[model samples]
Target chain A: MTAAALEAARVWLVVALTLLGLFFSFVSMVGVLRLPDLYSRAHTASQADTLGAGFGLAAVALTVGLAGAGFKSVLLLFFIFVTNPTAAHAIARAAFEEGIVPWTNGDERR
Target chain B: MADADPPPGDGASADGPVDSAETSGPSAEASDADATSGPTTSGPTTSGPTTSGPTATAGAIIVPVEPTSTLRSTIAHVAEAAANDGAPALHLVEIASWRDGDPESDERAAAAERVLERVAAWATADLDDSEAPAAADVEVVTAVIGADDYLFGADDYVRVLAEYAEENAADRVVLDPEYTPVGNTTLLQPLEFALSNTSLSVETAPVDRPTRRERFRTEATTGRFVALFGLSLAFYLLLGDPTYWFDAVTGVATAAVVSITLSRVSLDSTPAIPRTPMRIARGLVYVPVLLYEILKANLVVARVILDPRLPIEPTLNRMRVIVGSGLPLMTLANSITLTPGTLTVRARDSDLYVHSLVPWAREGLFDGSLERWTRFVYYGRRSARLPTPRERDDVAILQGDDATEELPIAAADGGAVGAGDESDGGDETDAAESIDDEVTDR
Candidate 1:
């Protein structure tokens, strides 16, 4: 592809990934609010949040174009991917240990 | 918490309350309980179940049944107390999480029955052996409660047990020291606290608990040390400039310190040369599959959350996995949690207690796609192609009964059917055994 075409494609890729990131983050927020208990809340807090962060980081990394900062962003993405679910697990486990029953269909929203 | 071995060890130790009795005493029990701090205090602060002499008169002692080593001792302790009270009814209750009409309800109920049966037999045996032969008549009533309800937290458990205790006119509740209904996550504190709010006095049976240190790997291998040193050095250099003399010096120093301190504990096992690199490459292949799953499930969960109707079923199910233990199990558990709509609530022995948000998610979990992938990652293609959890009869809905897929009694005997030991135990399953051998061969 030509230089102008390549640059345009890169910009579009960044925009799309950033938008996707924002969308997932918005969903995570809604999920945390709407989901009934700690266990369910963690589903969004970990998975949704990590995906959101992941897409956002990917966009940033692409925009920076494979240099030092880009590598750092990728590393940050890796850390978030590894740590996010673990944090959620710890929180859910704490809640479980505390004797907080998970909310099911019939139970009142907490 | 990330490790998979603690639960089984904890469960195994907790299940043998009989052994705990021999090891039990005021000094040993006190210091040990002090480390945990919650369950021990909650018990004695109330109507003084373990303190203030033997004639405390427990009208009915409700003991939540789990397969902990402390359970045998807890039963013996309760039986002794019951004997002192002169024929107080001993209620053995297993809190189940099931709706009235789940397809697996019968299987779940049968599992609960087996646990109760074993515990009741132990209780009867203990009573028979008691100094007070008159206490041999101690009525042992076992029932599975929470059958119709969705029990999620300590309050729910307390609510059900309180209702059961009230029905039986039980005044005291004796819990096994390691009575973590939801696997290794210790629920004793919250259960005790919640139960304290009720009329029934709560007490964690003063049994000898295995020290937390014993649960961890302590032996440092040369292979593990070298592997950790190499990885640490790589990580350090990656963060800093590889060409810088300062960075190289500091990196080596840091790597040495890390390897020296954590070589034994960090990695699950010693890294084999070509095998480790091969596994890493295969593991890299798994990332796309995992990411795809995450993306798809995220959309589904997001849609459900966004929908006005808010369609969510939120069921806890159990699946016995054969991804071996330690790092492999941690990988599977974390992957399950990372996938939206399903959260791994606990990992006790080979069983994963997963909470599924919707029917779609629950169905996905039962499908064992991720589990199969996990096996493929850890054990290889042949192991991955084995029967799905549903097909293998290793999956169950733990909602109603304390979903011990196999009885904890069997688990305590070191015969908990997992990986190699399929419950069916005959015929074509030699295929599974040979595969298990293949996995261990690594």
Candidate 2:
């Protein structure tokens, strides 16, 4: 491929990944607001948000190639992958052990 | 404030009972119950079985039922051990090991029944039937346990008996000395060799493998040292061209040595990665699936949130973990947490507790895609193969109880029928009632 075509392809990949990431990140907030319970809301904040941030970083890495910035982006993705779900699990377990009952259909409101 | 009222969706802090009072201002409770906090704390269930008083043998011991004399001997020894330990309960589990291609007919159930019958027969011959004390040994109450595997074995293939024991909340695990099956003898080792490998995510426990410290100082850490040095060198190379390659290599080598030495001396060291190209490749497949699900999930969630009337129904779901070990179990929990619609609340032993954002989201919660993928990671590619006639049949059962659904239970003798399936009895009873209704209607 020509130099211009290669650059265009890289730019497109960056744009697409970032767009997908941004969309998921914004929708994750919707999940937090719309979902009724603590556990349900956590799904959006942890899963989608982590994936959003991961995709954004991945885009940066792709754009930067093997440069220092790209490597750092990959490292950041690694950290997020490891830590995000772990934090979610910790909070969920604490809530459960604390005697929180899960909400089911027709559950009484507060 | 009334429980009967629909959820207050007008958007002035809908976070809940903790946050409802935060309208005055964001209170400590508000911060604590925020979206990041995760999982609503609402209902309180029956008190934990252990909360009342301290009892040494208050817990239970899980023993997988094998048909051989070894199982009978194991029961006798385990009963003695339990008496010694003060534990009074024994959970006899029959793992009907069936491969994926088996017909969904009652064959697996029959296998389970045969094992349970042998256990019951042995117990009758060995123990006293009276309410009074039977033998000089401590009273061991045997509870038959069941797994809804075979149908779900692809999703619940546990490699170790200890893991199965742990999943059932039975801390004291006692296995038969060896598993000498019929003609072709398969020797099953005791739990000693099996419980060696521990969780990799955290320093949960020490695996049976050699400590990295003892081995690192010699042969194994050499590779890690080299990898670290190479990474450092790569970092430098990426930064810019170096004046002297030799200088950079030597400098990175020194740093790598110090880093490895420090880790070697550190009290808590991370687990050594069981790296293989195939495993990495399998893990990589999960990433795209996750990302794609994130895309679909975001769209679905966004639609739900953006709905005019704010239609939402939150629910909790539970399922037994049929997978192996802490690593596979953790992977399943973490994956559920990372999924957009379901957040895993608790993964105690083998039971996974999750909260789903909507009722539709909870549809295949117990027996679905996530489970198949989890089994894949735990076992291998074959674990993820499409269901044969039997597995697909389970998917139908999930929808509704058909009048002529399944006759597998009829084949099992009453004594061995409910072996480990305390929960399954209710479902089967429902099927029977549905069948009765059909007969009367006809």
In lDDT terms, which candidate is top? Answer: 1
Question: Chain A of candidate 1 scores what in TM-score?
Answer: 0.94
Q: Candidate 1, residues B1-442: lDDT per residue as tens digits?
A: 0111121222223223332232233323322321432332211112112222333344778889865656666776776666546535778888874434543467767767766666665565455444442343466778888877545457768888988877778778888888866443567898888888788877888777753323122332677889999999998898789999999999999999999998857865557775688778889999999999998898888888888988776767667775645567788888898899898877665667788877678667867999889877865677688788867777665442223233322333335443233343233244333323433211
Please report the TM-score between candidate 2 and the true structure.
0.48
- Quote the positional error of residue B377 for candidate 1 in Å: 1.4
| Tens digit per residue, CA lDDT, model 2, B1-442 | 0122233322224344532121224232332321222221111111113232324534556565555434545554554344335443445565554333333226545655555544543332222211112112222233323343332221232344445555644565554554322112233432233334332111111122232223213443455555555556666555545567776776677667655675333312123355333555677787777667655655665667767765655655545555544466667777777766677776544556666665445544534677667667545666666553123333212112332222222322323322123243335445534534543210
Misplaced by over 4 Å in model 1 are: B1-220, B400-442
- Best by the TM-score measure: 1
TM-score of chain A of 2: 0.88
In order, the Cα lDDT scores of the candidates are 0.68, 0.50
Docking class of 1: acceptable
After best superposition, candidate 2 residue B392: deviation in angstroms?
11
